[model samples]
Target chain A: GAGVSQSPSNKVTEKGKDVELRCDPISGHTALYWYRQRLGQGLEFLIYFQGNSAPDKSGLPSDRFSAERTGESVSTLTIQRTQQEDSAVYLCASSLVFGPPRETQYFGPGTRLLVL
Target chain B: AQSVAQPEDQVNVAEGNPLTVKCTYSVSGNPYLFWYVQYPNRGLQFLLKYITGDNLVKGSYGFEAEFNKSQTSFHLKKPSALVSDSALYFCAVRGFTDKLIFGTGTRLQVFP
Candidate 1:
């Protein structure tokens, strides 16, 4: 794809339900990131993946939030037992690579999740 | 830890006037700065970035930013504002951890 792509642009789920969001990064990108944006809030880092190394999950808010990436391609973010506070826009971004000075990151449209 | 701060929640400027959006950052090592723009219901779009070299970095859409190492600031600037420039702007910093930390963002309203 020309840019990062996310699926299910909009989602509404019950408070106790689980939701999975998918992301497809640009071809050849070796770095992927996931972030969440609450209403009127800045983007919050969630997880990061670089190659086959263990993902940087330091930013994951809680055990309920988990993400995985296969190789350097598609990634998935799963939020279990969603809470009302979990309602937010989930964004995905991919960069060419990661190093001391990272390259530009291309973002996806994001998935708006509403936990009712 | 790395962090970014955008003090102003919103800025209003008239068309053809100079515009500025303030940003400050804290990091352990040399800071790599970036500016991104967001329209309503849309993902962020990269504007410019400052890595190494000149303090003044020019980017897409006639936007530029100046990096001040001493002040720990990277402020976005446009000599002549346009109403079409009205949107949300964010400042980010890449720290020693190799992760980008974004600021709260500032909404720029360029009125005609």
Candidate 2:
């Protein structure tokens, strides 16, 4: 079976510029999530999208960080006016469904963003 | 808030030797525990998870973890180590929220 995939394996952008990272979840997955992994740190939850429901944006560090998933397929995480601190690996994951007994999340290779 | 802690920043073990990576969690109600491994320059790979039922949960690549309810811990363990098993391991917990809270991570180095 095909696993999750992400585009732009690496991205380098100016500090003030905006960058968009894309994620393609596995087929038939109904839930998708985005997270940020900084150097020497743990993964920070960014956002979550379930089929037809309002995305959970509680983990977004600032208003500049936003994400959107169309239906139950691809998703895009956009960082507006990127900052040096925004440099990190953006990872995406998806599962069959979200639950009390949550399903395992399959991850993508991730997009490494470097804000210079 | 829900959180996880990996006490050791790094663990070194010789190949064919047993290895253990510690993880403790704090969360309200019953916790959903997970283990993930990351190779350098790559994304995370799910190892295993402890949702309920058994105390010991087996996962991919001959790895397993024990979920201790009273101790609030879910420590990853392997009976024998392999050099190829070296990587960054993370313990995560999902509480009442939809998001998963991850620990700082533990680097495992298996030397031949």
Q: Residue A16's C-alpha lDDT in candidate 2?
A: 93
lDDT of 1 at B95: 76
Find the candidate with the highest lDDT and give its number: 2
Q: After superposition, how far is residue A13 of candidate 1 from its true place, in Å?
A: 0.7
**Which residue pairs come into collision in candidate 1?**
none
Q: How well does chain A score by TM in each candidate?
A: 0.97, 0.97
**Can you give the DockQ of every candidate in the order shown?**
0.74, 0.86
TM-score of 2: 0.98
- Candidate 1 Cα outliers beyond 4 Å, as residue runs: none
- CA lDDT, every prediction? 0.93, 0.94
- B1-112, model 2: which lDDT tens digit per residue? 7889999999999999999999999999999999999999988999999988999999999999999999999999999999999999999998887677999999999999
TM-score (2 decimals) of chain A in model 2: 0.97
Instruction: Give the deviation of candidate 2 from the true structure as CA RMSD.
Output: 0.8
- Model 2 residue A2 CA deviation (Å) reads 0.9
Pick out the ten consecutive residues of candidate 2 chain B with the lowest summed lDDT. B93-102
- For candidate 1, the docking band is medium
Using all chains and alpha carbons, the TM-scores for the candidates as numbered come to 0.98, 0.98
